[model samples]
Target: MTGMFPATSMPDRDWWEALWPDPSGLLLSLGVEPSMTALDLCCGDGYFTAPLAKIVSGRVYALDLDPEMIVAAKAEVKHLGVSVLKWIVADAGDVAELIPEKIDFALIANTFHGVPDQPALVKAVARTLKPRGLFALVNWHQLPREHTTVLGQPRGPRAEMRMSPEAVAAVVEAAGFRLLRVVDLPPYHYGAVFEHKG
Candidate 1:
């Protein structure tokens, strides 16, 4: 948790969503289908969870480590008219225990770089997924601290906390996930999709 963003400091949900790529379209591009069960790991404010619920026919688990974030996400999605999501307040590293059922897809957005033990987190995620389940991650592209902090630049974790795409892929591979593909998400981020080998 050295470089992680504090839950208390999170921006308004609408404001946060406006700052990044659309989660629904992004998930669709990553091969997320309407019939899949997905996990929105480290989900913050239901920004991605709401859209995921709309797209996935099966259940979507929106889990965050902070209890306040879980409450906020639940309130945020109440008006979506969709009841496909289950909110869980737990650490990202405890997915295996927190999520009892197998999942078809697991999504981690903008939070992987700050994970204290990337390999352990990936392993836990892998364990929660069914065989061949997809694990998609969106992270800040490695850049200089000054570059990310400039006025009008997209808000993200510090540059030192960012990890290169290759580094993230390597961790996923070491955790028993086969590399699928990496896609550029926009002016400031990249998405990597992997498949659970187990």
Candidate 2:
């Protein structure tokens, strides 16, 4: 098991822009439009959110808990001239409180399992989206062995912080989201698109 992952302070613009999920191609595959407002939950540095803002010329609420990470994400958006993304400080419990309305899309990318109360989050984010809103749930596929990043960086979370797809799916379905697609293409990590049921 790995130790507590530190919030690496990214002083440079590139590092902040690089801190999100890589399976963005999957996001593209989901048919994201250029005029729909979206919410990016646990949006670390909002990397994907940046690209997403470009696609949706609409607003993106980039929500996260880490203050420095939130700051870095906003900086990146400003640097990239992305006027559509808004940074909101939030954890699992405070998301609904921050944005108490519906959005066209909701993205929980790469950071769902880190949440302490998974069920609460499922319900909270579900309430925040419009009926039939598209929600992309993405996480690392359970790899067979520990892996290293290309930069020789070890990547693994503490055992208590990880969650499996089936386990997560149960919570999401219970919150009224119907699984629309299960993407298992390449490079390992998995994602499920849940269409919020009205």
Candidate 3:
């Protein structure tokens, strides 16, 4: 868990999964179903990706900026006998190209904070998702000036890239998504669901 995060994650997936253990259930609460096809953006080690694969019971594509993490996730999925998932590496922009258009659901999770190009990311998300598709985003709440950090600096105060629910909502809305549900997940993270505008 210590090295897994590389100072770039909300929390490494293994550590976070151990704490919450119910992101899949949370996704279910947001209407994720076996009948749908889904994508996991920034899926680190297939933590939520595995569960999403189960939930969709259809097609699952897990995208990650870190190729090492994607390789590890693919290994885990193979060990788990989960074959419906496809692991791909590259930025969300590359994902936008590969998936083309109209996926039923897409999730960014805590990865939004790591993305350097906010507009390109939002536009890519908008382009790939179907109208009415679900997009779930999760991130940490804002903290005071002395308790937050970015890119490994205990630099005091949450960076803008470490988007809050409202901030992420703004981006999604601006990209043609509408807010749907805001959910409390494990301790330091939360989830927001949105629907692509029709």
Best by TM-score: 1
**Across residues 5-99, which tens digit of lDDT does each residue of candidate 3 receive?**
22355345545555557767877866678888888888887777777787777388888777888887787667666664566777676678878
Off by over 4 Å in 1: 1-9, 145-154
Off by over 4 Å in 3: 1-7, 10-14, 144-161
Per-model CA lDDT versus the true structure? 0.79, 0.67, 0.71
Q: TM-score of model 2 relative to the true fold?
A: 0.81
Worst 10 residues of 2 by lDDT: 1-10
The total number of steric clashes, by the backbone 3 Å criterion, in model 2 comes to: 0
Per-residue CA lDDT of model 2 for 1-198, tens digit only, reads 122123222234443234334435656766467777888777777577677776776477887777777786677677767865467765646677788567888887666766556787788888888898888887666653255132234443444455577877788999999988877634545677889997
In model 2, the Cα lDDT at residue 126 comes to 80
| TM-score of every candidate relative to the true structure | 0.89, 0.81, 0.82
Better of 1 and 3 by TM-score: 1
lDDT, model 1 = 0.79
Tens-digit lDDT track of model 1 for 35-128: 8999989887777787888888538998887788777778666767665456787777878898769999999987887677888899999899
Which scores higher on lDDT, 2 or 3?
A: 3
Clashing pairs in 3: none
- RMSD (Å) per prediction: 2.7, 4.3, 4.9
